[model samples]
Target: MLDIDEFTPGTGSYEWHLSGDRLLWSKGLLAVYGLTQAPDRGEGFFTSVHPEDRARIRQEMAEVCAKADRFEHRFRIVRPDGRLRFVLDRGVVVRDATGAAVKLSGVETDVTDVVDASTFPAGQGAAPAARGDGRMEEADVIDALFNDAPVGIGIWDRDLRFVKINPLLAEMNGLAPEVHIGKTPKELLPEVVDIDGVTSLLQEILNSGVAKRDVEISGCTPARPSERRFWKEHFFPIRSAGRVSGLAAIVEDVTEARKAQETIDALLHELNHRSKNLVSLILAISRQTARSRPDDFLPVFQSRLESMSAAQDLLVRRSWQDIELEALVRSQLPHFAELIGARIILRGAPDVVIPASAAQSLALAFHELTTNAVKYGALSNEAGKLTIAWQVSADGTGLQIVWRERGGPAVLPPSRKGFGSTLTGAMLQSTLSGEIEADYSSEGLTWSVKFPLNP
Candidate 1:
């Protein structure tokens, strides 16, 4: 029987035989120890094992050999150069004719590689064993979930090293995946290192072991200039054995939605400011117009101003965005109707809707026309009738309005142009971008205008 304990540079070997109840190491084992002769007869080669590993190695070897178990063990030895090297031995215990253990034989391989953990190839060091068949399959499922999620997902260790990061997570942070893998946020992005708020939030997530969702985080990416990105961040504890492991994060980008919300807020602020200013202007105009007019004309001026106010009301309802011509006409025509009784007929394309700018201009023009009819056109005579008709041209390029009167005593042109007439003509030409014509016929008067409907 032979027991080899350590590895030396030179190799030696010899056969050993047992005589009388005494067992001795072979000449090869003696030569391996750099001795020309065998050791003291009773001393075992286990003495050659380094002092730290001798007892445990001997105990483990005896247990395995006695139980007829597989021989597997590791120990260290001090070489001739005074360097310690680790060795692993594996072999079976040989049995005698009576099936009783008599000798042990094995092969020893240098395992210094395993003892120096860093020297092991990446991912080849000691890891948890698959105690159950389903463990690895479950791990595979977890890996798949991390890889396939549409939203960004990542796992960080307690030390802030990225244990796992999906491709989507890397893209969301505007970094290539390899750059983030196995790196800490402080290592990859130094700007975030001293950010106390960020550090606190991360620590809170790690310590609390509770999930937090939609917590907004800023300054994730500083390189992009187009706009700052907004993120709805979710943090949760990665638990193992009912203890908090680290943190897992899921991020959702919401930059566009945030911008839209900001724009809406700004518009509301502007609209409120504009509306207050407009009301102030209207009040001032109303007070001044009444104070400057005679009592008899005050009612007429107030009525006209009211019509103007109605048009502005419509515009304000639309957030000053737009207005419909038909809406403006419908809202104000009842007041004009009360003045003329059955003497006037109104007709036009009631379906036409115009912009807010044009609606205000056209509403003022209508007020002028009604005022003129009440004063001199046809409403001045009890027996007279006025007919107002309008239509759009074939190409929808323009609108033409005709105001005709009949049963008046005589038709004549006024020597001086009236304010109402002047207002209607100027507004039709300037505001609506069209022409006005007043035709004095033998039976009555006819007032007509053609305006472009470009709006």
Candidate 2:
């Protein structure tokens, strides 16, 4: 095998083990991030990446691991001094005997200077001045970055006329680079964008020689008039010979990111509403339990709480979406989990899913039925048989459930209604907006419920 220890100036190697979640970096690799040592175990090394690029990098790496062995990526990093640098990353995933990805090893190289030189190109008028060591002059460095930074870049003279703009900015503005020259923001941009605020800020920067970072602008672009776009901009004065001559800006499009954050906000709002509803439910259940069984409060209440918690766990596991009927039944009847289809019969449409709003009520009802069977019905003896089944109505919009017991001690009507019976009957009916019926006879107990399946 070829030696993989090769190292060069401005380049570093790294390896990570998926099993241990461990990352090891060569000294040169640590130096690339201005660190003298490896990060603390799993220390979020991605934090060094620019925030805007972090998610994309992680997603790309994941896709790479899933679909291919080799990968190449370029992204920006912020060093200890808070300066930005561009790096090229290339890596390979190591697979084990079972075709499982076991490790990842990679090399990274600082490519900022080379990319800058390429952006400046060979024939962009006069040659840029150079230092004694042949390094590029500061002016040329600025010119290069203004021409080809990843974000939109542009310069406007004191007269507020566009003097220069990079291709990315030109595309964002829905105009060609040459068309932007000698034009004011208002003249080139769509009226819908109404760039007066941006123009005023540019004027302020030009006059005061002050910089403004993270200034936000939102409107529709001519290229996409229907969808509103957002951008975060940085504006700073361009100075020559100790005098402010123009204003320059870099703009980053954040339209997708803005939409994503808005979605997260909406989800959080929904979660808060659901949490309040859950607390109210617990309070109501507590009050009813205390009134119904004051003497045996702890045991009764605790069992009921466990039943609700099992349903909640399923709901959470499914991200609050529909819960499968079979899964809910199994969870609510924990004592018979391993005995399904043997002594405890279960029949239902495997595809039927219970709406989240009705899941808890149904779960509680199942729990009560099972508990009662164990005490005075089929589950009380060896010869007992329990059949729990459900089916969708002919219209497919309603559900019917049955709990039947046989072959054990016969059950009789209680002297009076209890909390457990209420949970399986009236409470379930009211919660699901449906009908329930219970029959106690010499053979056994048969309880049935009908409800609309939609929430």
Candidate 3:
């Protein structure tokens, strides 16, 4: 066993022996002070300490010696090399037989690795944490969580001033985090009305002594060039000294979710309405098919009907939110591949995400295009190639997609519209609410669709 007076280095630790106004610092202490010598006054350990902390360290030393009482304090020391070092000073006070203060000893550990001084336990007389690391230590874990977290975080003070902000919340204001700190919601975040309103809500918590949790709030960020979307905000109160002090809010940018939900609800409503309306269309189609080919009850038509239902099933699976573009393309192209005796080449970014409603519409439109191509266009021949490529814009505003066909039958515009034409047109118009063009040339057919990105 080691004697209490004999300080041993464990992990990052140091021992300091205080006797009168002089200190005998261990090798570990010297290393932390960035000193060249152990217990050598000539090493200038005192000068290495940050000037502001020197007096407090001295005063605490005097009190420990005067009362012969155990004491602890934290202070910053400037390394002889000029780097600031944060250290915790803790030790016992020893006395003589007459009870006169003789020695004060303790250990100083460097805790600079941890981020966020507020998160660390600051002992009495512990120096206000060094200015270096702003984040609470263990930033890697936080970084991973920040990327995966569905909600946003914002740290604020009692005065409603922002202290720290997570990337998600920072992304909300279209501003970087550094620009937001020390700014009140109304001052820097005028774009965030919901956050500005949180000021009063936090005030209520402060005045009433009650913490607010999971309170639902909604508002829009400042208008961007395209569209303004809304978000649902959740405010959580941060407390200090057993009193409501500031706020730690988590914001969920639910604009897409809300829009998707609305689209689903609307689609469900339209599905019901169209289920009734389509009966007439189905009856007409059945009558027309029966009249045109009375003896031939073409069961192949049932397969087509099944295909439509399967498409609806896929849409329902995503709740009309979005679908995997590659999966959608691959799932719809196999039949056309066999018919045309060629392959549909899909070349683009892998796993590029798209909205649900857009997926449903794009899937249907592609299906119709492929069916028509197999029957009349490029896919009709084994020598043909159907290539599709997509790329997202730098601004993230929209995606650019190009579909080109080569070495196929000469293309010509349809003389009259058909089910495939009407279906493709309607689906693109509804889902993208943007742009579509099918250019027919002697070479082949080129189909393109531009879908709006924002909800």
Best by TM-score: 2
lDDT of 2 by residue, 1-455 (tens): 22333344456778878778888888667777887777755446788876756766777778877777766666777898998776667667898887777787777766554343333223221233366897777767775776678999977767776656787998987876645554578767755355887787788887788999998888876767788899998998877556786777889999999999998999899899988988887787788889988998888788989999999999999999998999999998887777788889988889988899898889889988888888889989988998988999999999998999999896788888887878888888899999998899879999999999874
Poorest stretch of ten by lDDT in candidate 1: 9-18
> What is the TM-score (0 to 1) of candidate 3?
0.37
Predicted structure with the largest lDDT when compared to the true one: 2
TM-scores, all models, native as reference: 0.44, 0.63, 0.37
Poorest lDDT segment (10 consecutive residues) of candidate 2: 120-129
Q: Rank by TM-score, descending?
A: 2, 1, 3
Model 1 Cα lDDT, one tens digit per residue, 194-224: 4567667878888888788888865546445
- Quick one: ranking by lDDT, best first? 2, 3, 1
> Which 10-residue window in model 3 sums to the lowest lDDT?
2-11
- Report every candidate's CA lDDT: 0.61, 0.78, 0.62
